[model samples]
Target: MQETLRRMQKKRAAGEGGFTLVELLVVVVIIGVLVAIAVPMYLNYRKGAANKSAESDVRAAVSAVEQFYTENGNKYPDDVVTPGAVGVKVTFKLGAATDGQQVATLSPGNTLVYKQLTTGTYRICGMNEDGKVVYKYESAVGGSVKKTSDANLGDCIGAAAPA
Candidate 1:
């Protein structure tokens, strides 16, 4: 009986059909490495997307200002759009708001600065995740638009006009 039991035990040990602890650990490590690599990539992609979105918003605002200028005798918008100001005519259409609210605010928690240098000379600038002005559109008084930054916007400057 003892000899039979030993033979059965040997058969069971030989037929053990599962992964060893080392093999499982290796697989887990590989998966962990992959996750570590993939997560940052995805996060960067998302950040890039946000930056582009903010840039697009600035583009739209530029277009609106240009259109308004063309329709109103080539004058830049005279609205105070940065919130908490008064006594200015908000005479531009910047994406769902025509009441002096900055178009940059449409980007949802993005830091965008807007300035009207002179009559028909204006700039709309937006910051990236690193708080750098990576996107900017400068509208000169002569109906010309130019891109003035290349910090973090990818492929967004392909259509930039000569400064």
Candidate 2:
């Protein structure tokens, strides 16, 4: 028994007790597979988040425009303006609230446009950081917000124009 224990100790000291190359390779392959699966899911989650943010911005803008119209004798603002407040990077072509027109403040990397389709109808379109999706809020469409994918900035205005 003593001799067997000594032989076993010697084998361990000779670096013969750890994982084999095949075992290590298997672990590495498993990790790679997990990473491959996780990366795309993470990227998809980020894209969905960005799209939701754009939609939120569009909704807020629609609320502000509707408020402005209601408060200012039922007329939509012709232009949007940035308030230049700290931590507010958004700019609007819609005029300032002080000018009897209120505009929504948006997150950074977002672009918003206000279109007065008619005297009583308007559309607010917003795009997020990715710029691949556009969120639109049209007053004439039952005030529902809609999302359009694979869209360009120009499409936000021209493609959705009311005939």
Candidate 3:
């Protein structure tokens, strides 16, 4: 019985050597393929998320600017737009507006910008993840807020927004 048991154990050990190099290499290749596929997907998702975050932030900034206009005698606030008690500051600069021009263009700064086109009309721009200013919000006196552009851009002009 002992001799038979020894023979059985020797047979099992011979048949059950560790995985071959080919099997290990296959496993490594599979892992590499999976990583290659997942990395680009994850990066694209991150970029989309960043764009969405910028959009939401731009909307919030526009709302704050509207409130600022209301609080400050129907004129848009200059230099900065601070929202709520927490005081998130959106910087703004007054763009040059020639006579007979109806659209007031607001160029975005490091933060955001608010441009008063007329007595009540306003335009707001915000910075994208790339640090470029894109037109985000537009409103006329007694009108609703309109989203102007969605592309990340250098200036809010031409294809970016309505002239």
Candidate 4:
């Protein structure tokens, strides 16, 4: 029996060995665990990036609106429509009839039915949502492009000064 065992050991050492099923299973399980952890983390990171992008888009829109306001002597164009070239867009309707809101007419006014484009001109407003100013941006030209502040879109706008 001892001789037989010695011969078996020699065979095993001479490249006659193979991995056991249990060992192979362990390696597979370890890889699966790593994948499970890594996939969700990557997904979460992507979502955060999207939200940041949207916030940025809003800021850019705000700056554009301010620029329009300043340059045209408080005359915000009533319909700053989105150009065809624009991919992403954010549309912002001028605020309601309060808080010094300009009424739209033949000339420039505080209230505008305008659409914000992600590519070209855009607008963002700090809407009075239940006291806190919620930043929302609407794309003037709408299509496959995403402009809303969410996990899907990171910071869409430029690092513009808020209005």
Q: What TM-score would you give candidate 2 relative to the actual structure? A: 0.77
- Tell me how many clashing residue pairs each candidate has: 0, 8, 0, 22
The lDDT values for all models are 0.54, 0.71, 0.50, 0.44
| Highest TM-score model number | 2
- Any idea what lDDT model 1 has? 0.54
- Residues 27-136, candidate 3: write the lDDT tens digits: 99999999999999998886665455555555665666666556555666543331211124343323223311122222222244455556666665555435432435
- Candidate 4, residues 112-133, lDDT tens digits: the string is 1244443454543332212122
Tell me each candidate's TM-score: 0.59, 0.77, 0.60, 0.45
Q: Write the per-residue lDDT of candidate 1 for residues 3-114, one digit (tens) a residue.
A: 9989878878999657799999999999999999999999989777776755665666676666656665555566333321222222323423453332323454444445
- How large is the C-alpha RMSD of every model relative to the true structure? 9.2, 4.7, 9.0, 13.9
Q: Which stretches of candidate 1 lie over 4 Å from their true place?
A: 1-15, 79-105, 128-130, 141-163
Candidate with the larger lDDT of 1 and 2: 2
Task: Please give, for residues 27-68, the per-residue lDDT of candidate 2 as tens digits.
Answer: 999999999999999999978887787788888888787777
